[model samples]
Target: MNDSVNRPADGAPISVVLAGGGTAGHVEPAMAVADALTALHPDVRITALGTARGLETRLVPERGYHLELITPVPLPRKPTGDLVRLPGRVRRAVRQTRHVFDDVAVDVVIGFGGYVALPAYLAARGGVRRRRVPVVIHEANATAGIANKVGARSAQRVLSAVPGSGLKDAEVIGVPVRAAITALDRAAQRAEARAAFGLPDDTPVLLVFGGSQGAASINRAVSAAAGELARSGVAVLHAYGAKNTLDLRTPEPGDPPYVAVPYLNRMDLAYAAADLAICRSGAMTVAEVSAVGLPAVYVPLPIGNGEQRLNALPVVNAGGGLLVDDADLTPRFVAEVADALLTDPPRLSAMTSAAAQVGHRDAAERVAAVALDIALSGRAARGRRR
Candidate 1:
């Protein structure tokens, strides 16, 4: 895929459009690569394509990247009325996306499979009057989603978080996580991290959280066991969802602090403060937790195509962590499993080492390099055609 293509002239500016909006799982990876590209080539311009309904409406702007809004064409799971209208919805989104490409003079398109991606892919393949741009696809799930599967057909390069993602011959580059997570040193920052949360310095700490909005089942189960865990001298730093509530008996002066917050703005410090975690096994969550070498009892959400379970499988199989079913993650289960791991430092240490080994800390830079190459090559190809 890297066969020598024409190279853009020295100091020439390059532009890229990233199409991976909707959820944090898709947006975070896209942002990480965008950051990498900026760090590597200050002259590079980046734009993000997203729908108004997705998290990107806020997250993209918050990250200081320009976001272009497009009409969302949500694919219905069943043969509903929405499915019947899919073609026209797709046409409108594709048209809007093509306008963004023309306005930006986009050198290349890098997509992390989602509702916005299919339109972007089709737009990149310009019509008879327009020039087609190179396309790159990154599948961040264990199984390739429909949009990614379709994009891969014409993609110049295809990447995956794991093998067997159903995008045949795709390169395996672990999920792209921000430098903050990839560079975190849990052991070295443990003291300061604990102090930040008011957690005790000498006790085992268990961190509990759901995704951004929070998981109700996880909140109920973990909060129910909070008191029992505190009595056993285990400190808790729980980021209960901003939308969820936790009822807890106030800790006495001697009891290890149970610092409950609505959200965790500093996940690096959170990872540093805890020896283990009980959280949902979303793709980004797995990448971040495992990247920091923090052992976790991953509880995959019971819904969806079971992709969450697949996301954590390699880590669990590598002995870096354990996986428990959502239905089995009761209050008692949390208490027992957490106590067993926290009390056994040797086991925890082994698990930590395994987790770190499986984490591809350089994944962001690796993907960024390939994406930049594709952009430059496309520029080169265009120049030659001229």
Candidate 2:
């Protein structure tokens, strides 16, 4: 069977429509897949659709891709004043998507899951009564997000980052990580990464980050235990969100040797140098940590429908990491865990092995192949009609 259809004989580029954006969680994976598609098929044209409220306005352009903006409203739970306004917003977004499809002559729509994805899915499924377009949805979290839940119905194939999400017709493709992270040569790169970061080669490195925006609970917990962790011979690299940086106290002299930054622009190096990680369990973070086989002590964000906890479940269950609740995250607790993991060489090695076992290094390539296949299939079907 031809799993991925070959490129058109005319050498014309296949076109793709990508929908989903709001946070880096959604945008980053979409961009990764786009990059992979570009590499695989140099002639592929990628057009991204996102909302003005998302990071895509800056991110998409920075990556040298075209972006179309649409209006999106969050889904409401109860019959409130917001519910009355939702239909109008949804209708507007759907109309905008219809216009985009016509303008771009889109072949296939790939959704990464956000309010922006809803409209694309609706249009692809003929909800707007337009020409049918193939739809694909990728759910990165173990617990499906609202947008993915809606998009799944219209999706021909649903790809998940974690397995056993109970969604029918789903493939466990793992999460797409940036190319840099996936390409790193762990053994050869480790020492160089440590030297570039000005960290001692012999010190046990502990990478701490709470997503791009940073987590307040994690910041506080790490700060409180900085001294204790330092005494236990662990070097900490903390990426505190810009907004939360002011709230953290400057570590005094002789404390855990930490290099604190507002954000880490070079994540590959951070992962390369870390022997262990303490972080919130965002889907992307979990995937990155697992990709590099960096063992972690995960403290899932205790808010917003338990999505973070769900993201970490598979790793924890697989013995790739430890799960700690945010409410239970204390200075003493973090220090104890960090010390235990850092000091025990055999246990740390085992966790690292497990993490590597669960990582899908080819996720981006696989997802890109699926998108290209759908686009090629659509083109073939159109030719037959003629």
TM-score of 2: 0.94
Number of backbone-clashing residue pairs for each candidate, in the order shown: 0, 1
Q: List the residue pairs that clash in candidate 1.
A: none
lDDT (Cα) of model 2: 0.85
lDDT by residue (1-386, candidate 1, tens digit) is 24332234645678889999999999999999998878777778899999999999998999899999998877787999999999999999999999999899898999998889999999988889998888989998999999999899999999999898999889998999999999898999999999999888899999999989888888889888877897777888999889989888766677778888999999999999999999998989999999999999999999999999999999999999999999999999988998899999999999999998888888788888888898877666677888
Question: What TM-score does each of the candidates earn?
Answer: 0.96, 0.94
Write one digit per residue (lDDT tens) for candidate 2, span 131-189.
78998889888878778888888687899998766567789999988799888766678
Error in Å for residue 219 of model 2: 0.8
